[model samples]
Target: MAAEMSLVSVVLFIATGALVFFLLFLFAKRQIMRFALRSARKPHINIGADAPRELREEIQRRLTIVQSVRFEPTLLSEQVLEASKSVPNHYLHRMKALDAFTNAVDCLRSKDTTIGLRGTKQTMQLYLFTLCPSAANSSQAQIIDMFCSSYNHARHHPANFGNAELTNYMELLDKVIRMIKDNKKRRAAALYPAVETEVRLRRDCGKRESAETVRHTGKSNNLRLQARRNQPAASRPEHVEQFNMVDKSSGYSSTDHSSSGRGSVERLISPQHSFKPERDEAV
Candidate 1:
């Protein structure tokens, strides 16, 4: 009886130990499965869409404000030396502004919806401000004209565009204008004769071109007037007659004549006079 009891106790102990081991194994498996599930169920990173509407609008507003603040041509000329000295260092600031403008434009273009009128105007203003010269004085106009020509070349010509930089666009303009102004200041200097000669040549060329354009415009306008006049009074459309009458009323006179056996006509008109009648009639 004593031996049988001892054997029974030993069997019970072995069974208890086996049960504990099984429970531990089950717990470990459950924990491993939970860890794997957690690892597999991670959240994704979010890279949101383009700039928000509010931010874009704010940028556009700022751009408009910047555009309206016109630079004074006389002040710019007076401070040319100072601008030259500061430009190299402050170039990065200008570049940052340019980048902001570019990014804003990109955001504006990305949307399928039409930008509001205000937004469109602001964008155009920003583009002009960043890319065009300030409209302050006649000097500024000349600088702007040159800058525009350069910009067109840059856009169309790969070599020119490659050499172009934001700083180059901004600073070079001021530099060239300053150099011209400085040359004018030193007109009595030893280099004055050569510089004056170049200036005179440029001035003459500009005047000649302007005169040619005026002559061509006048000839074309005269031809148009003559054709309208030659139209039989019955064939003269009401609008054409009205237009001619308005032109005559507003200081524009048309003369029909014959030159070298060819019918020649002349029309003397001012743009202001031509447009004013139409505007007044509309109003």
Candidate 2:
């Protein structure tokens, strides 16, 4: 009986050992799976369409603000007729555009020029290049170049910044803000076609007023000349009638200097001096 109990004890010990080993194996497997999941998994961030409504609206508003800002008389305007010469209408870079737009508005409104100034400076360079071909000579371009040099040195040679003073690029920031504001105003004005029409009407009215003034002045001068010639009042009408006559007179006949003075004055405004923005280039 003692031998039988000993065998049973051995069997029971082996079974308990097996159970413990199985439990240990399962625990180890669970631990390994947990580790793998933690290492391989990444936190998901909802963005774009998946982002919240408020976040989307804010982003849209910022984008619209930047889009409203325009650089007039740009290379785009000069070659507007040719599709081949067209520059794609878009911001310089996406991330940079967002940062700069936000910073510029903050800088102007809240006077916050702490962060995002670097991005703003770079955006200005893009703006200059797009708006004007002679961007290299612009004051903003010079400032940005200096900023780039300092930034590179500080980034690559950190030891050199120990005694170096932190450069203030707020002036360039100011320039960026100013340009954006000016552009916004210009674009806003352009939105109202009535404003342009009113301006044209005013210009036409001024031209008519000036012409009437010139005409009255010429009439008075002609009367003075007739009076000087001691012509009778009846003959004055004849002289006035002659002045009013068209160039349909005899061949190569000299025009009356006083009467034709308006045409001469008008001719002084040469076509060469007028603005002609069209360019000659095509595929």
lDDT of 1 by residue, 1-283 (tens): 9999999999999999999999999999999988887787543432222679887777667866985564311112225434644674323333322333333333333541222223334433233322222232223333444444454443334442322344334333333323332333232232223321111222464475322221111111133323533556575333222212212112211122224321111111112111111111222
Relative to the true structure, candidate 1 reaches a TM of 0.20
Candidate 2 global TM-score: 0.22
Candidate 2 per-residue lDDT, tens place, 1-283, comes to: 9999999999999999999999999999999988877786544432356778999898778866884464422122223324333763222122122333333344344432222222333443343332222223333344434444443443344433421222122223333333343334333332322311111222364465322221111111123222423644353222122212323222221222454423321222233221222332353
Pairs that collide, model 2: none
The parts of candidate 2 lying over 4 Å away from their true place are: 1-28, 40-107, 110-174, 186-283
Error of 2 at 114 (Å): 19
In terms of TM-score, which candidate is strongest? 2
Stretches of model 1 off by over 4 angstroms after superposition:
41-283
| Shift of residue 264 alpha carbon in model 1, Å | 42
How many clashes does the backbone of model 2 have? Answer: 0
Best by lDDT: 2
Q: Model 1 misses residue 279 by how many Å?
A: 45
